[model samples]
Target: MNITDLMWKNATAYGYTFTRTPPDAACAARVTLLEWLDAGRINPAVARVFPLEQAAEAQRHLIEDRPFGRVLLTLAR
Candidate 1:
């Protein structure tokens, strides 16, 4: 098995065109995202939330090819 062997494995890239979209449309999408999070539609994929300094730890894990999903790094509160 090789990297190129998985070409298009993730399918098409998707994203929001906030900069190009009208302000109202962009705002609506943002609101929708917030609502989804509030309603538990969006949840953390990782077991732990890493503090900012843990960024280096996260990088090492990623570089070492450790299992991961959404790695959330938090700011000081």
Candidate 2:
């Protein structure tokens, strides 16, 4: 199936479940992520840390759909 067909199927199956977010909703999402991180609700097993210099490489890995969880860039030590 093509992109449009996939999107229509998803929409029909999960009516109104996907939509653009307002500014406030975006802020709320950021806050929720921060809270989850602070509360240690996010599992380390699902996280990958990389140095700033390797950010491009990280993006390539993600775009290629390499195996892993969240990819993060960190400051140099």
For model 1, how does the per-residue alpha-carbon lDDT over 1-77 read when each residue is reduced to its tens digit?
A: 24564565854544567899899998999899899989999874674567898999877766675655666689999
Candidate 2: segments with Cα more than 4 A from true spot: 1-19, 44-47, 63-65
Q: Each prediction's Cα RMSD?
A: 4.6, 6.3
* TM-score of every prediction relative to native: 0.55, 0.51
Total backbone clashes of model 1?
0
In lDDT terms, how accurate is model 1? 0.74
At residue 62, what lDDT does model 1 achieve? 68
Top model number, lDDT: 1
Model 2 whole-model lDDT (C-alpha atoms): 0.72
